[model samples]
Target: MTGDVDVRRIRNSSFLTWVGLVLGSWVGLLWGSLLFMPVGAGFGIAAASAMGGYIAVPLWGTFWGLTGLSGQRNKALRDLGIKVLPDDDPLTQRVGALAARLGLTTRPWVAIMPHNNAFAIGATRNSAMVVLGQPLINTLTDAELDAIIGHELGHIATNDMRRMGLARSFQNALVWYFGFSRTLQRWVRWILTWMSEFLILAMSRRREYWADAVGAALTSKEDMISALEKLHHKPRLSSYERHHARLMIHGVDSSVFSTHPNFLQRKRALEKEKYLRFVKKPVVAEEVLAAPVTLPLVAEMAYVNSK
Candidate 1:
């Protein structure tokens, strides 16, 4: 047998984490949170802090997570110093028009990155920003570009960032603040963090597929398909951005922690969805055909609103 070991599968497995969660959640929460009781009694802290340990930290963490303007800070992008696309730029106009169509309360600031990838970031739709790659601009047609932007906007429209952030903060509070029962912080934290997988249960992979459906509906199925076909490679990203892979358009294919479906899987799923171009208007005294759309009506509404 070759001495080279393949740990690729093991790295992303959440099986052990799940086991620990099932067995340790109650013990960790009940014991850890109440430890503040004895700690307060011994240290003689203020009555509010003594009594507040259980609720305060969690609320604080969640508030910061949900309301934090993540896109405003470029540290996550490794200080790449993003320059916002010009308002008069064709691509910028397309992005703005698409944002309006999606009914996003916040007008996303579109920036061009040197990498061949794109992503959306913000705690909520109100703070969303869309970062596009320079290379991707030259690679796709106008329609394809709109479809790609539409996919990113779908993420903003659903407020995926805030949801994921809230989950992360909630779990962090439970792990760091409350997971200290009888000073056994190490064991408690391990269990809690393992259970949450760092970003709380990890954003559902379904969101990626849903975004694809929305993109297809907003533009045309052909454009969406073409865009996905062109972007088959694993995206190149800076270290910090790679750390935030869950927010990007592309990622590892078959890992449990991956935020996107495999390209083939996405394409196949899109084959069964309803795009605006595919939806036919009703006609009297004519043969009527039903469109087999597996996606929700929200996609249709989004498409219609854009028109």
Candidate 2:
């Protein structure tokens, strides 16, 4: 509304691009590794070491990646002074309420982590977890918190979480090449890290845009814009090292090849389109509706439908 609202169609371009990057990198890594596989095998360390590297990279990456996100959620929750609902708590009842209102199948898990960020990830439509940073919770108000949660829900609704998880899995598998410590191995890791960092950054940027659109669609563009503006007030650093102190939860150290667009780029996008143009919620309300009321009903329906 601020300018022209020429929303582009979801071309799946970003998804495809992510896939290509993962696959290409995997193939290159494997092919290059095989070259040294012989040397490793000659010492009888090739089969075990190469295979371990192959398997270990993805496994380790997935484990730590998920662990890092969980850490972020814990940090954010603590900072926000919000209670994390116990598995059987009445708040679980509210899951359906929020999900139905947001038009999602499940309510994303809201947790805190130690960074200044938020993200959503899960394999199934019903299994989303939204992790937020402690800094974000401490810094933003309740309305701002809602807007941020809404944005993360947007990621779940768009299935970006699942897609991103897969991309990360693939990238992790390819990182097996890093297990060896040769000049070429180091060089390859460096190059691949550079390339993966670039691609991940790009994919993250597009997903950020898409998620912004989603939040705007569910809540209101103004809320999203307000949230972004709130973020703008926080620190902004140029280099990866400079930003690392704040990005602990997402563990999105650009140095570590994690998924995240540059911070400034994110801020600009929110500003460009007037972030709140698409959301439906008013900035202020009598009480923040934590979740929708019909949550149980929809959950039941979803359960029945699965049958």
- Which candidate achieves the best TM-score against the true structure? 1
Cα RMSD for candidates in order: 13.4, 13.1
Q: After superposition, how far is residue 302 of candidate 1 from its true place, in Å?
A: 37
TM-score of each: 0.67, 0.54
Per-residue lDDT, model 1, residue 136, is: 79
lDDT of 2 by residue, 67-152 (tens): 55445444544544544545564434443344455656456665555546665655555766665666776877666666676567
Model 1 spans > 4 angstroms off: 1-28, 31-53, 70-78, 182-184, 198-204, 234-240, 274-307
Candidate 1 lDDT tens digits, 241-303: 566667777655566666667788788778866323222122434333354445777698789
Q: Which window of ten consecutive residues has the lowest lDDT sum in model 2? A: 1-10
Local distance difference test values of all predictions, in order = 0.62, 0.54
Worst window of 10 by summed lDDT in candidate 1 = 1-10
